[model samples]
Each structure stands twice: as structure tokens, then as C-alpha cells.
Target chain A: MRSKRALRYGLLGLSAALIGVGLLRQEHLEVLGKAVRICLECVGIG
Target chain B: MSGMRRNRIKWPLSRQRTIQLISAALVNGYIAGFQKGRIFTGGTKAVCVPVLNCYSCPGALGACPIGALQTAVGGVKHHFPFYVLGLLMLFGVLLGRAVCGLLCPFGLVQDLLHKIPSPKVRVPKGLDRPARGIKYVVLLVFVILLPAFAVTETRVTPPYFCQYICPAGTLGGGIPLMLADPALRQLAGWLFNWKVLVLVVIAAASVLIHRPFCRYLCPLGAFYALFNRFSFFQMSLDAHKCVGCGACERVCPMAVEVTKDINSPECIRCGACQTACPTGAIAGPLKKQSPR
Candidate 1:
């Protein structure tokens, strides 16, 4: 039972880590670039 | 299927529902990404994820309530943000902090943290209740006063609650965004370091202490609490049916006094108390207060 719970959590953590990576990977670069541009603009520069 | 297997299947479905809500938050942040307008246009503008998520967080969909409140208060206009406040009140009256228990991405992080196979701490009633008031003070000073009078002109600012306090911002929006972008990495100055440190402390604390942020510094929780008494969705305890056995209280994750005030602000409406009651004294919207 305890090992089952561990496996469940392990899967969940793995998925979140994957999503986090996916969010940063090649597909999400446009959003990342835009967000960076906005943050820089907020601080008064390019 | 056997009873145990049925229960096991149900648990994963429930967790999936929670994941769906986190996706909804992310989608909302994506939609609201275009706007970061000035103070007169209701200064703070990030959509609040129930558990006091930060407005400046990278993936945040809408204006954070606490940040909005602080910016509105601190803005030269110095009037309450009627639109934001009204929207928050409506949500509170409808759902209470069920948003925290089920929907918040940050709350999801804490739930994940609690699963880390560590010693968990249950705060004693003597200490927990008083400590819960800290968010109110944060709302008063950081969200309200500091932004209202702190500056001479209406300089738009992220509320201090978000800048210094929110772990949700740290986890959901901050770390993820920084991890994705290298330029954001270069800009990681003293303030960013401070934010990360605060996030680390909160993340570590969440492992031992169940939702220390929700208990202590979530201004959104504080706001929802104001409407808990009058919220359309509420928990009711029948005095005649309840034997005053401490079962409901013991089951409550948020440590609400279920018998005395089932609708207390601290009650996240997790439905644990309803399930815990052997006599079935506690009832929800579908059930009667007295069980007829």
C-alpha cells in the first residue's frame, strides 16, 4: 500500500517536472521571449 | 470490481479534476498576458488563483487580488477597486475557499509537497487560530496602507504581499518561467534572489506544515472569509443531531471549529467534516441542516 502511494506520487512529480520542462522547451520559446520582453519593458529598457 | 479497487479508481479521477483546474488557471494567465496597464485602470490586474498567487508571476492569467488591492489603495486615486473587489466578493459568496482546496495551482504544489514522506505537523488550536490573523494584517498594511500612501505619485507597483510573500508565485509562475528563459535568468538580481529564498522557505515549511501560506498570509483567503457566513455554498451543523463529539473538528484539514461555525472563514469546504460525522450531523447544500 505504501509503495503504491509512493509510485503514485512519483508519477505525479514526474509529470509536473515534464510539464515544467515542456513549458520551457522549443515550442514555448515565443511566449518566453514575449514575457522576457515585457519584464524588461516594465523595468524601462529593451 | 472490489470496494478497494473502486475507491482507488475514484482517487485518480478526483486528482485529475484537480489537474484540470490548474490547467484552467494557466489558460486564464495566458489570456490575460497582454495587459499590464497603469494604476488608474484598477492598478493590479492579474487574475487571482485562490491561494494568493502572485500578480507578477510569469504565467499568471489575471490580476492578483491582494496586489490589486495594494495598488488600488496606494494609487493616487486611493479608492477601493470596486470591480476587482466585487468580482472577488462574488466568487467568495459562491465558493468560499473551495478554490484553495481544489483549484489553486499553488495549493496543488503544497499538496504534492505534503506527499514527500516527511513528518507532518498539525498545528495546535491555541497557536493556529491567532496565527491565521497574519494575512489580515498583511492585507491592512501591505495591500492597503503601503500602496495608498507610500508614494507621492500613483506609481504602479506589485503588492508587497506578492513580491515578498507568495509561494505560489515562486513555484507556479516564477521558477517555471525562469527555467524557460535565459534572459530572465540574467535579470535574476537581489530582488529575484529574495523572492526565490522566500519561495524556498515556504516550500520547505509546506512539507511539515499543511498550507502555512493559506493559514497565515493569503489575502485571498482573508477576503473569502469575509463572505463565508453569507456564501451561497455553505456547511451547516445541526445542534440537535450533533453530539459534540470532536470528530468533525478532527477531520477538518483547515482546523475549523465545525460544530460552532461550520461556515467559518477557515473552513475550506473540503467536505472532510461531512464524511467524518458518524451521526451525519453535518450537511452540505444537497443535505438538510437537521437531516429531516
Candidate 2:
């Protein structure tokens, strides 16, 4: 039971850390750059 | 008999359905944009919603997580999808498939289709068990491998799932775009027709089956299902209160054996089982639990 709790916390912590890194690196901007454009490829036009 | 009476009175708009409606409206609330047949290409599009809303949907305010993940992985730059992966992990740990049961726009569509009066068909367990694994295969192949490895000379990886599959994109983006733009109508070809066929099949099947796509084809649902056992918001069964009546099992849309595996990956956390429990054995979200 204790181990399970530890694992859960560990994963949550790791996810938070990853999110922090992603924000710090401004990966959201990269995603935004792609998203704002209507990609012809996504809609089966390309 | 009394339970049956209560359920019959509640009929078409059950508590869950009401929640589903509100969620669908809230998530896809760019109503004016839909009216104008324009997709919102705003800053919010960078952020991934937990649900399977097509990013190109006229009314969608946020990007689909599955679509964003594929796009990020399939880019020419091809860095790891840290933002998407982190968001998915965070959502999985927090809510699991509750997002599927309540928040997803596509999920609401399936639920409503299943509610239509029709002869129902349960997939035989023999075939169903193996078929459930297809979503994971989809996640592994279409979302991951094809994007990462199947690069072109220009270093661009194809968004295989969005291009070839994804009935949500077909229904939400393709139909709406074609309807709105006369020029886009000329661009429609074999691929567009194929996607329309796929959408029709899924839409037709949902009337007879409870969430055929979620059960067998949704990679997002498959991803979230992996966290069902450990998700913070989850259902628990009090053995002392349970009479082993199996009423919960009967009410489950996902067909989970509620008494045995309350935390089954297939369990959508819709609270039908909890509501159906005569003894009130099932409780949810843990924070709502009374002191033992």
C-alpha cells in the first residue's frame, strides 16, 4: 500500500516536472504556431 | 420495482446525460464561429483539451490532445512532445476516463446515438476482449511509430491518424468545411469519401452499440484507461455495504463487472454503478467519502 502511494506520487511529481520544463522551454508556442495555421495535410487535402 | 419506476421517470435526460450536454456545450462554446463556419485559430488552440474534439471543428476552442500529440511528433523539427505528454499524464492521473464519460464531445455523440430506440447488440466477449487492444495498437502505430520513423525527404512526418482515420475530423472538420467553402468542394476526393464512409459506419454502429469507438478504436480512451487503477478521482466499493446484487454491472454502459473490478480500465466513472447500488456500496472522487 505504501509502495503504491509512493509510485503514484512519483508519477504525479514527474508529470509536473515535465510540464514545468515544457512551459519553460515555450513548447506551447511551437504547438501554437502549428495550430493557428489550417494544415491542409490534417484535413486530407494534401 | 421501485428502482425501475425511479429510472423510468428519469428516462431520456438522466443526471449523466445532463452533465454530458453541459460539458459538450462548454467545451465547444465558440458558437459564433460555428455560425460563421470558421475554426478558431487562436492562442488557446495551442493547449490540448482532454476530450477528442477535432481541432479543426468550427466551434472547438481548444486543440484535441490526440491530434496535437501526433502533430508535435510528426513535425519536421521532431522534438519529443513534452507539453502534450505532460498534459495527458496530468489528466490521466487526475480524472482517468471520467473525461470520456462526461467531457468529450465525441463521447456525447455516441451516448446520444445509443440512446435512440433500436435493437442493441453486445459484442461477444470472445471477439470483444481481443478487439479492445486495437486502440493501443493505434496509439503505438499511427500516433507514435509512423510519425517518428516514416519521415519524408523534407523531414516531415505524416499525421497518419488524422489523415487516414479520425471520424471526428471527418464529421467536425471535413463536412463543415465542404459545406462552408465552394472551393473546398472541388478538393473532395477518394480520401474525403472514405472518411465520410467511416463516419457513417461509426455513427450507425453507435445507435446499436454503447460507444463502439470508445470500446474498440479511441487511442485517447486507451491512453487514459492505463491510469484507471491509480487515478486520484476514482470509484471505490465498500465490501461491507455491497450485497453482491450485480445491479451495478447491469447499469454500466462500458459493461464492467463492478463488484469484482471497480477500478477496471473499461469503467468510465460515469457513476451509473454508484447510483444503481441499492446498498450504496459504491462512492467516488474519494474526497466526497465520509469518515469511516
Candidate 3:
């Protein structure tokens, strides 16, 4: 039970750290840039 | 014969089905674009919803995590995909495959298809056991490795899964785009035909078999399944109350043996088992008990 709790916390902490760094780096804008454009390749058009 | 009997059982409108419908509608609610027959290119598309929605869909407001992950990994500037991974981990820890059962639009499609009045086919256990591993392979290869490593001369990675394999992308984005745009329709070729064929086969399979894509092909489902055992939301069996009748297993669309493994990776947390449980032995998001 202790181990399970520890693992959960560990994962949560890692995720938080990753998200924090991603936000700091402004990686979301990159995602936004890609999302806004309709990629013809994605739908097998190209 | 037993499977046929179970399928014939009149399943009344349940809380889970209601939730699924609302979730699907809410996720794809950007109807203004639908009228224009144009995909939303708005700021909200930056945010990835925790479902398998295509950003290229005419009415989609949010980005798809899988597509975003592929794009981030395939990008020339940054290859780590910290944002997508973090977001996915957050969703995984919170809901696990409960996202698949209650939140995904594609999942709703599969559920509705399986509900069509037709002869159902149960995947034989011998083939089913190994086939379940295929989704994991898709996650590892198509969603991750292929996009990250299969680079073009311009250093951009191709969205391989969306291009070649994703029926959801074909159905949600491609068909709509083709229907709306005269130029896109003219561009349709062997690749487009191939995707249409793939979508048709999967759609046909979903009618006979419950969630064939989710069971054997969805990379997103594969990723979420990893968190099933430890997610904050989880299914648990009150062994004391269970009569071992196996009714839960009988009704389970994901083929999960709920009595033996309440928290199995394949269990979608659709609450079918809970609704079917005669003694209410099954419960979820259970409060942690004090260690004895």
C-alpha cells in the first residue's frame, strides 16, 4: 500500500515537472500552430 | 449461443450511455464551423481534449493528444514532446481507460455500431488474447517511433498513423473535408481509397464485434490502459459480496473478466458490469481502506 502511494505520487510529481517545463518553454504554441493548420497529409490527401 | 442471449437482452438507457452521449456532443460542439464546412482554426485547438477527436474535423474545437504528440515528437526544433506526454499522463492517472468508455467520440461510434441489430461475433479467446497486444505495438511504432524517426528531407515527420491507419481521422476529418471542398475531392487517390476501405472494414467489424479498434488497434487506448491499476479512478470488486456468477464478464463489451480482474487494462469502466451486478459487488473510484 505504501509502495502504491509512493508510485502514484512519483508519477504525479514527474508529470507536474514536465508540464511546468513545457509551459515555461511555450511548447503549447507549437501545438497550436500545428493544430490550426489542416494537414492534408494526415487525411491522406497528399 | 450464450453471447447471442446476452446481446438480445434489452439494455435500457443507463447513466453511462447518457454520459457518453453528452461527452461526445460537448467535445464536438463547435457547430458554426460545421455550417461553413470548414475546420476550426481557433485558439482552443491548442488545448488537447482527453478523447480521440480529430483536430481536422469540421466541428472539432480542441486538438487530439495523439496527433499533437506525433507533431511535437516529429518537430525539428523540439523532439521531447513534454507537453503532450505530461497531458496524457495527467489524464491517464486521473481516469485511465475510463476516458475510452465515457469520454471518446470514436468510442461512442463503436458502441453505437455494436448496438445495431445484427448477428454478433465473439472473438475466440485463443486469438483474442494475443490480438490485445496489437494496440501496444501501434502506440510504440506508429504513434511514437514512426513519427519521431521517419523524417523527410525537410526534417518533418509524417503523421503515419493518421495517414495510413486511423479510421477515425478518415471518418471524422477526411470524409467531411472531401465532401466540403471541391479541390480536396479532386485530390483523392489510391491513398484516399485505401483509408476509405480501412474505415469501412473497421465500421463493419464494430457492428459484429464490440470495440474492435479499441481492443486491437487504438494507440491512445493502449497508452491509457497502462494506468488502469493505479489511476485515481478505478474499478474494484467487493469479493465478499460477489457470488462468482460471471454476469459482469458476460455483459462486458471489452471482454474483461471482471470477477477475476476488476482493474484489468482492458476494462473500460463503462459501468456495464456495475449495472449488471446483482449484489452491487462492483464499485469504482473506491475510497482507500486503512491498512489492517
Candidate with the larger DockQ of 1 and 3: 3
Q: Write the per-residue lDDT of candidate 2 for residues B1-292, one digit (tens) a residue.
A: 1111111225577666777889878767788766777778778988888888777777777888888888778787787888889989998988889888877878888977776766677777888889999999999999999998899998988778888878888877778877887787799888888888888999999888789999999989999999888887778889987889899997788888888898999988788887777877888852233334
Order of candidate numbers by TM-score, starting with the best: 3, 2, 1
**What TM-score would every model get versus the actual structure?**
0.71, 0.92, 0.94
Complex DockQ per candidate: 0.02, 0.62, 0.74
TM-score of 3: 0.94
Q: B138 in model 3: Cα distance from truth in Å?
A: 0.6
Give the alpha carbon lDDT tens digit for every residue of B1-292 in model 1. Answer: 0111111123544543455465546634443333322111121233333445544455455555555555455544555455445446556656677766666666666656655656667887788889999988877777777766667543654456656666665655556556665676677676667777877888898777767877888777787777666565677787878888899887676878788777788877667687778888887754444454
lDDT of each: 0.59, 0.81, 0.85
Show model 3 residue runs off by greater than 4 Å: B1-12, B285-292
In model 3 chain B, where is the ten-residue run with the lowest total lDDT? B1-10
Residue-by-residue lDDT tens digits, candidate 3, A1-46: 6887687778888888888888888888988998888877667785
Worst 10 residues of 1 chain B by lDDT: B1-10
lDDT of 3 by residue, B1-292 (tens): 2244234424676677778889878877878766667888888887789998888888888899998998898888747988889989988888989999989999989988887777788889999999999999999999889888888898988888888898888888888888888888999999999999999999999988999999999999999999988887888888888889999898899999888888899988898888788888888642232222
The superposed Cα distance between candidate 2 and the true structure at residue B120, in angstroms, equals: 0.7
Q: Which of candidates 1 and 2 is the stronger one according to TM-score?
A: 2
Give me the candidate number with maximum DockQ.
Answer: 3
Of 2 and 3, the candidate ahead on TM-score is: 3
Show where candidate 1 strays beyond 4 Å.
A1-46, B1-10, B13-51, B55-59, B76-78, B152-158, B285-292
Compute the interface RMSD for candidate 1: 15.8
